[model samples]
Target: MTGTTWDILLLGGASGIGKSRAAARLAAGTDGFIVEFDDVVSAVQAITTAEHHPALHHFDHAPDTARLTNDQVLALQIATAQALEPAVLGVVRNRLTVDTPALIEGDYLTPAAAARAVDDGQAAGRRVRAAFLHEDEPEQIAANYATREPDDGDQTERADVSARYSHWLAQQARTYALPVVPCRPWDTLPARIREAVD
Candidate 1:
């Protein structure tokens, strides 16, 4: 609890890192509303001129990035995430005006953006907490994905992207002085996130 506008617990990390699960666990014991980054991005895509927005690629027909280089994939994802930042902040702003706190969980909630939100007073609360979770090992991350979607044919690509993004996120969190939680499959990750938020 550090800010004065609204209480927000921003969970950011790579895919398959259990952010949504962590947020759900956090919400169970707290009066917090859940806002998925995908939902906001999807809603925005539905209303806006998505054709012109690079971030809206998740909607409609997405380009097959299987053949693209790793850097290209990262660039595409980062662009989309950056584009979703405003909408995420909008959701945060709206939720703040209400009485309930919010648990915003997503890969798109970059450390830089979270820090900006706090510094800009958008996350005004006595408990403005933000952290990044990651499974450093690509094989472990791929294993996590397998459990979620057993038919995933792009496991290798997904794992690579997750590893790269997770590394970047961890560094970003450290750079911003935010908590960095290692969410290894065997760990009690939700508890770690709870500790970070508390």
Candidate 2:
């Protein structure tokens, strides 16, 4: 569904994977609006309590990042994504009935979650495209991070997490038959992303 034909586009990937840029580029290239999935997670957290959304609130207090391992961080992300899957689906279902030309951006909708949305959209005869941007090389992601934030110091740890998370997302995308676009060769990234979701 070339952006124009889709009602909602589910754009997902790990942090620092150019998802934000993809959303902006895609939105600019089409008649679509951007809606951060984090906003939905935040709204749900605001109306709920830790007891109800423990995964979503695990990092509410912003615990020490140094204390956690990469696997641990990945697990937290998976848990949070699991907790927010329903909300994501709810938004997709709601959009199916409305005229919202939105591109939902974030890691909240993992490939599994996005598959559900795609299935629902199919059942309702609505177009909902999903694409995930990934970078297999952690070093490349770190370099991109550096380019995005020239003043920021080394981002080795962050890049490691992002790389690992991106691998997981890519694998899941393959399993679900979803699009997994490369975020490399930065110059052609935007065009590739637009083509992938289209």
Of the candidates shown, which would achieve the greatest TM-score relative to the real structure? 2
What tens digits encode model 2's per-residue C-alpha lDDT throughout 77-131?
A: 7777877888999988988887657889997778988999999999998888898
Instruction: Give residue 112's error in model 1 in angstroms.
Output: 1.5
- 16-134 per-residue lDDT for model 1 (tens digits): 87888777766775556788887776677778675676456642344566677777787777777777777766766666666667878888888877877666443355445688898
Inter-residue clash pairs, candidate 2: none
Q: Whose lDDT is greatest here?
A: 2
Backbone clash pairs for candidate 1 read: 1-126, 1-127, 2-126, 3-125, 4-124, 4-125, 5-124, 6-124
Task: Give the 10-residue window scoring lowest on summed lDDT in candidate 2.
Answer: 1-10
Alpha carbon lDDT of each predicted model: 0.74, 0.83
Off by over 4 Å in 2: 1-3, 60-63, 150-152
Count of backbone clashes for each model?
8, 0
Q: Clash number for model 1? A: 8
Stretches of candidate 1 above 4 Å error? 1-6, 55-63, 121-126, 185-187
